[model samples]
Target: MRASDPAIRSALDHVILIKAHLLQLRESLTALEDVRHSPRGVVLIRRCMLDVRMVFEELMLLSVSAHGEAGDRVEQSLRKKHRADLKIRGLNELNPNFFPDAIDLVASDEPGVAGRFTSVCEPYLTVEQAKRIYFRSDQLLHASRIFMSTEDFEAHRGELIEFYGLTERLLRTFEIDISGTGFMVLGHLNLDDDAMPQVFEAQTS
Candidate 1:
């Protein structure tokens, strides 16, 4: 896809939204500490779960946006499927290449010249990760019986922390390769104050 392609633009827009979601996730995670002893602690946990779930959903939508029309079809199909596992499986089938295996953080010492940098291509937050978190969130969000006790809820705190860690690593500075054209690098220069999506493009090898 060309730099000016609408799909690229849309994907970048999603990136912006994802950044906002991440910010919310951070707030929810921090609040967990303050409420750990309070009865409302469960609320914070639910918020965290919701935030993680949103990130997963937005990531899927962003992937779909990268594919243009084909992605649109997958999105339509996803709308009818309420199962998170199926949605992820369908997206994987649509095109696994749509998801980046690793993100390259290119550093440039001079203007307009790409330089050496680090690559984070670890297999974190893959489809399986999404499925696990998504379904867990669903289970916690829609309680079929009495809500989890504080002890039970506390047990899952470790998992929530892990989710945040993996998500941060995945989005800290990542590259999404656009087939046939190039790839887009989406991240934040300063995640605290500069929460905006900083996007850069480069040709694929």
Candidate 2:
């Protein structure tokens, strides 16, 4: 929280902005108990899903800014493990430092290495899942013919919410326990269905 770099401050601000949008999306979802999707709600949710998926990429960019080579190593690991063309294209759009060769960034035990960062990320989102979400979000962004049924919308809503919370915890607290079950710590941090919707309303109003 006390970092001197302007980039760190920017990263924090971006995270807060992303969180706000995600919260607002949830607020929209709350009004749809009987039906799964409204036209407005669908648009908002898709936008938020795109943003939620970008949360990690943004963080990785920040990590690259802070740690340079170490961060590059992690990004490269993610890229190599991630085979999808859509995701590769997305990665290409990010900072060049986030691309490079030759390091096991995910499993390395060395202190201050990118592996620590990747380790924190692997459980919540593997490269494969990231690619899937990235492509789906892109499709939704383009107003492509992709359609989400009521059930699909609900499932995506839940998954995006969890992803947002876990990414938040990793970015804000620098905590990661791959050994532990799911993001329980994140669930405790105001991400619950009951907890966040109320707080989000209060903050927005």
Residue pairs in steric clash, candidate 1? Answer: 102-121
lDDT of each: 0.67, 0.45
Question: Whole-model lDDT, candidate 1?
Answer: 0.67
How do the residues 23-104 of candidate 2 rate in per-residue lDDT, one tens digit apiece?
6646645654444576765776776765655554543444334434544654675556543364465444443323211111
Deviating ranges (above 4 Å) for candidate 1: 1-3, 37-39, 102-114, 121-124, 178-190
What are the per-residue Cα lDDT tens digits for candidate 1 across 1-205?
6645776677777777777777887887788877784557777788888888777777776766755775676667667887777777777766565554445557778888676446665645665676787898867887556767768777767788887777766666666654323445444423567646765554434
Worst 10 residues of 1 by lDDT: 180-189
C-alpha TM-scores of all predictions: 0.80, 0.47
